[model samples]
Target: MSIMALTPPPIPRDGPLLRVDRLRQWFSSGGFMSPRLTVRAVEDVTFEIGRGEILGLVGESGSGKSTLGRAVLRVTDLTDGRVVFDGQDVSTLSKRQLRPLRARMQMIFQDPFASLNPRMTVGQIVGAPLRIQNPGISRSEVEARVGDALRTVGLADSHAERYPHEFSGGQRQRIGIARAFVLAPDFLVADEPVSALDVSIQAQVVNLLMEIKRKLDLTILFISHDLAVVGHVCDRVAVMYLGRIVEIADTRTLFRNPRHPYTEALFSAVPVADPSRRRQRILLKGDLPSPLAPPSGCAFRTRCRYAIPACAEAVPPLAHIGGGHQKACIRDDLALQPAC
Candidate 1:
């Protein structure tokens, strides 16, 4: 690797809204004398999102995208590393300390169906954050905030009176969005927020989210597998493989001039809009390997077509290629085809 590849990306002197430093979330199973197996769901991941910026994380089902998202939000116990949010070292905070911090940082869960409390009315669900964080706020203030959040997501105030079971899939997600937005958080981890909704409904939700972001100037970490949706909403994109971020760059650069083989393969599968144009899909031979026993060197080397013997020597760092673009693969000669 060149010296440039060994060098780390410079953080903005002013700092970002959220900074994840070498974040790792590992799960252990099968104990005692049998030798415990550790699933490195998110391993040594690092990134930053500026104030009002939307950073997209994309990968297949088990690539640890959601796990990374949760780790950043501190929803699950992290095995190692640190998470700094808006100048605060959130990873070091106790549960009691993190409780009040929830108002500034929030998450919009993926499954609208499962995330909402079936028994609670929409108002109760949306107003829960405010009630918990700002104990001094009056009930009327909570109701007002709930109404505003609902209307912001295109829901009526009357809809807040109904139960989750009474709403359609789209409406339930809107309620979820309302709940997350009720705080008007400085940072949002939207973990596949629109994936469970219908395609038509997904478009509406995406539009609403973008609109809200514009109005509120919200900083978001959007996690999703949908590249097309990501290309539309994200300012920058990060691609994950197994438990590592393989590549990351500005949306235009990453989409039009992808640097990693895994990114090339993933983007090639994206369907085109015009019937006249066809994309040559980059198909790998094997399925994604289990994180329990991930391959050494480069975890993607087993399936990466551009893999060299050197790829098996040691894991490549997420190195800066040029112009804010970073790739983990060490090879410098391959000119992989762009997704666009």
Candidate 2:
């Protein structure tokens, strides 16, 4: 069997690369122009990614997946929570203090075009961090390092002289990857890295990322709204809804035997290549509730077909079923066995 097919099934507590606990980020609208409401971008969300593991974060656009990723990296402030990286808390770092530690964690943003500066050459863009981090390093060493990073991401050393707009979408993303990886970051946060690329090009980028992971022995947090892509690259998957993680499991387990209603709905919505063999897609009713005014208990209850009256009254804690599989659902009677 292929490595994708033969790998042992994922269990929740097997191990974690990064651990997040009760994370919350609340933004209060200010002034008369604002609604004077608090937008809870992330609320009491928790999960972990095993070392050298690809833990996919999947959710709808407003589901707070990106926000959670940013918060963990301490790119944004947190309202309440703890982000433990290799057992060290990241939330406690001061601006001046986070410098040395910043080298270990890096992010690949969704919009490659926007993330890169048009004014700077690719070499300068990639080498800038190195310049700041290691001022004493010689110019020749920086040039060599930048060239090596470009080659690692499959771009030629010559391409380092070009600007971001000069390359194709896929190539630009590769540049982003090159910039992020040049630092040799231990944990990489890819926020929808492939979502902006052409469908034909997505696979190439995905494969490149996978290859780099193996060669570099790096751990990654691959965030995306597409289940298909997540299935391809991630070892485990976490499904988020309305600022909270509704369910999380091994990648295969999530696809084959989704335990939570939200996860099941997601799988049901995926379109199959063959129209004749299509399973009925679960169409969620009503739009996602506004984060400023989320439902009291289960945020998904308003749209969940299996939601009960009690679901509206009590928030379901993520209860452990067995074998590290967990779900936040009151209806244990309907839980599906995790995929093997």
Candidate 3:
């Protein structure tokens, strides 16, 4: 491996909204101490989000994107590593200490219909977090705050009185968004926020989120498998494969000049409008290996066309190519090219 300069400006920690470092979350199936088999849901992932910036996490179904998002939120137990939010290490925080931090960090799950409580009205759903965080707030104040939150997500105050089933899918998702933002959290982990909506409504929700981020000065970690969707709202993008980050760069740089073979394959999958023009699709071979027994070197090497013998001997560390771009592939000759 050759050493290259990592000169991109490091994420400012002075007041970063969120910082995750070498986070690893593993699940044990059944293994003796000798072999130590475990499913690495998230392994050695690191990134940062500025006060109001959106950091997109993109990957295939089992690439551990959602796991990383949940891990940072401390919703799931991490096997090891640190997650610092607003300068506090969440992993080490006691339940009592973590409770206070919940007021500043929240999550918006992927499924709108499923995430909402069918038994509760919209107001109750949105106001639950507020009540838990600040019990001293009056009932009248809770209603007022719930109204404001509903209005913020494009819903009327009266809508809060109705049940979630009464609303459409997009509208339910809006309620979910309202619930997450109701607490006025500084950081939010939005896992596939738009993937479940209609294509037309997807833009509406995404635009709403972008607007909310700007207006409220909120920081977000947007997780999605849709590259185009991620590119639309994220300031920077991180591409994951088999529980590890293979490439990360600014949104424009990642889309226009992806530097990882896996990232290139993902870009090629995005559908285009014109039927007359066709692009060569790079077909990857083999299924993604189980994280418990992932390949010795690069996790993607099993399906990578440029894989060499050296790729099997040692894992490739993330190396800077240029700008803020970084990749973990060994084959320089197979550097990623843009989609035509």
Candidate 4:
């Protein structure tokens, strides 16, 4: 059967506002003469985001957190699996079919400077989505919405006339936020929205996102490498390693008692503010494996301290331990120490 013929029907909106099931995205590399290599950017990733909930996708660089976010939003085509948003099965929607849904689902990109068009003024940048999505709307109404959006992100109306280059890094991010929010989206994929800003300004942007989420009743998939930031803003956290979720739980639970070896290592790396409460840094062996040729069985087996012989035989399926906490490790003897 053709890919479109395999598309599932729209799901009920009564459950999670966003549901991604076994989603996979792969990129092909090498010429026809050479052996084709598939870079498994996202593989068998499954999760759900309830309405008005913020689910943080935390992983190190090259862990495919960003790819998973893009795949979920259908910004890129999926190699396999399904993505259901609100009540629609968006996994198979053509660009023309997805046009109407575009306004409801938006993304705040990682690079503020690159994401916004330098040629466009702040007002034009933020108002462009409104104009494209609702072409019949009056220009006056667009201006009103743009003003409100700028104000929402703590930007002044006068600033709207300015170009992206004129703003500070933080200010540029605020402009990006204004652009994403002006569409009045129900779902947003914030892919490292604060990663490019100053440490001092990171908190400010995060706070703005929190405020906007509350005000708009938004369901956000927050993708970031900073566990500290994720812990602060997200209701739940899903830890990804080598394109697969290794552990998932409520923010408090996951941080307090991480189960998987990779998840534990990640949490241990978070710097403790209190010198008295210093943690033993878990230094993993080697760097992240290349996605083009990921190791068989558990992708993390090579670096995982708790890996057994069985870990190399087959990938461990995610299993619930307790209280909505789940881990993919085969070992049952491991658990993260309670946080100080």
Report how far off residue 59 is in candidate 2 (Å). Answer: 0.7
Candidate 1: the clashing residue pairs are none
lDDT (Cα atoms) of all candidates against the true structure: 0.91, 0.87, 0.88, 0.90
Candidate 3, residue 39: how far the Cα is off, in Å: 0.7
How good is model 2 by TM-score?
0.92
lDDT of 2 at 69: 89
For model 2, how does the per-residue alpha-carbon lDDT over 81-185 read when each residue is reduced to its tens digit?
898887778887887788887888899989888999999999999998799888898999999999999998888999978888899999999999988888888
Model 3, residue 6: C-alpha shift (Å): 42
- Indicate the worst ten consecutive residues by lDDT in candidate 2: 331-340
Residue 225 lDDT in candidate 4: 92
Summarize candidate 3's per-residue lDDT along 1-340 as a digit string, tens digits: 3344556666565777788888999988655656656898888887777778899999999999998988898887778999988887888777787898998888888999999999999999999998999989899999999999999999999987899999998999999999998988889999999899999999999998888888778899999998888877889999999999999999999888888899999888887778997787888887889987898988898898777899998878888888878888877776566754
lDDT accuracy of residue 183 in candidate 3: 87
- After aligning candidate 4 to the native by TM-score, how far in Å is the CA of 136 from where it should be? 1.7
Q: Per-residue lDDT tens digits of candidate 4, residues 1-340?
A: 8988899976645889999999999998886899888899999988889999999999899999999988988888899999999867999999989999999999999899899898999989998999899889898898899999999899898888999999999999999999998988999999999999999999999999999999899999999999889999999999999999999999998888888889888878888888787567889989999998889899999998888899999988988888989889888887565443
Estimate TM-scores for all models: 0.94, 0.92, 0.92, 0.94
> Per-residue lDDT of 71-148 in model 1, one digit per residue for the tens?
898888888999998788888777898997888888888999999999999999999999988889999999888999
After superposition, the stretches of candidate 3 with alpha carbons farther than 4 Å from their true spots are 1-15, 30-37
The local lDDT score (0 to 100) that residue 235 gets in candidate 3 is 92
Give the least accurate 10-residue stretch of model 1, judged by summed lDDT: 6-15
